[model samples]
Target: MSQETLFTKIINREIPADIVYEDELSLAFKDINPQAPFHVLIIPKKPIATINDIALDDRELVGHLYYVAKQLATEHGFSDEGYRVVMNCNENAGQTVFHIHLHMLAGKMLGWPPYTDNAKT
Candidate 1:
């Protein structure tokens, strides 16, 4: 087992989160601070630090994360229209948490020009 991340705290029932879906390998939940109408954070059960921090052995798990995100998006009624999946890799990429996670956002027309100068602009 790896060191505990915030997601782990939520997974262990220690922290509070509006969870939408979960399985042995992953967990999906509403973002505490949402950027859109349907903003959910899908995370792995294992505590990998970031995208670059993921090991070769975690390749399948990474792919599965996207799969589960898509599954949950469909379940949440965002499959037909559209949705955005994001994984911030590092501090420069606006990653607040050190755990590897996928952000599934939809239910609104997202703006273009994804980010600006170390912040979402």
Candidate 2:
């Protein structure tokens, strides 16, 4: 068994988080370090480590994560205009937390290829 990650602790209620949404299989909360005007993280209650660790039986749960993200975006009043759901993979993808989670970003138009020096344009 892999070690319990930070997200696991949050899901277990061992730590406090600014929870926004929760269901039998998922949880959504505000990101401590906001990347956008409205930044929220939607994660499965199950500790699946990372996307690569997702099992075949977890397909539905993974789908539920996106569902929750969409629901939250609508609740946050941004679904109509637009929003972005992002999931970082491994270290190369800037995944500091190993747990599987989706970032729902909205409230403004986001730039493409976030973190670029604008040299590409």
Candidate 3:
């Protein structure tokens, strides 16, 4: 069998996380290394390596992930103020964890393009 991803461990209760929201189909938790004042991760109970790996049959599960993110934004008092939901697809997109997850960031305005290095500009 393949090794369990860190998120899977959290889902199975093998590891602890600062979980904020959870349902039968999904889990939401604070990011260990947050990029914004309010950064959370929403993941599915069933492990899918990345967005590219999501199967057609998993549509409901994937859609529920977004719903959970939206609910969390409201619950955390940031929905109307504005927030961002991001999903990194692969290594090139900065997806350190293989599991499919959505990043919910808010609490402040985010930079545009997400890259500001003059050298890269």
Candidate 4:
């Protein structure tokens, strides 16, 4: 069996989180480290360790995560302003927690190339 990831801990309520939304298939919550004014982390309740681990049957669940992101943006009153959804794959991509999660970022205009590549100003 695989090890339980940090997200599984959150899903099981083993650790405390500023939960924002929850449903049968997924959960949404405020990120401990906010990247945007309106930042949220939406994750599947099922423990899928990484994006590469997602099975064929998980397509709907994955799509639901994005749907939840849309719902949250509208509920938080930022849908009209737009938002960004991101998923990191592995260490090189900055996937800190093993379990897959989608980041919902908004409340301010975001820049392209979200990260820097050591470019000069």
Looking at model 4, the pairs that clash are: none
Question: Over the stretch 23-83, how does candidate 2's per-residue lDDT look in tens digits?
Answer: 9999998999887899989988888778899999999999999989888877889989999
How high is the CA lDDT of each candidate model? 0.87, 0.86, 0.86, 0.87
Give the per-residue lDDT digits (tens) of candidate 1, residues 21-92. Answer: 989999999998888898899899889988888999999999999999889877888899999998998787
Q: Encode model 3's per-residue lDDT on 1-121: one tens digit a residue.
A: 2358999999999999999988899999999888789999999999899888888999999999988988888888998999999888877777888889998999999988874543210
Candidate 3 residue spans exceeding 4 A from truth: 1-3, 116-121
Model 1 worst lDDT run, 10 consecutive residues = 112-121
Q: Lowest-lDDT window of 10 residues in candidate 3?
A: 112-121
**Error in Å for residue 46 of model 1:** 0.5
Q: What's the true lDDT of residue 97 in model 4?
A: 85
Please give the ranking of all candidate structures by lDDT, highest first, separated by commas: 4, 1, 3, 2
**lDDT score of residue 57 within candidate 3:** 100
* Candidate 4 lDDT by residue in tens digits, 36-58: 99888999988888899999999
RMSD of each: 1.9, 3.5, 3.3, 3.3
Runs of candidate 4 exceeding 4 Å displacement? 117-121
Instruction: Report the Cα lDDT for candidate 4.
Output: 0.87
- lDDT accuracy of residue 79 in candidate 2: 82
Clashes of 1: 0
Query: Which regions of candidate 2 deviate over 4 angstroms?
Result: 117-121
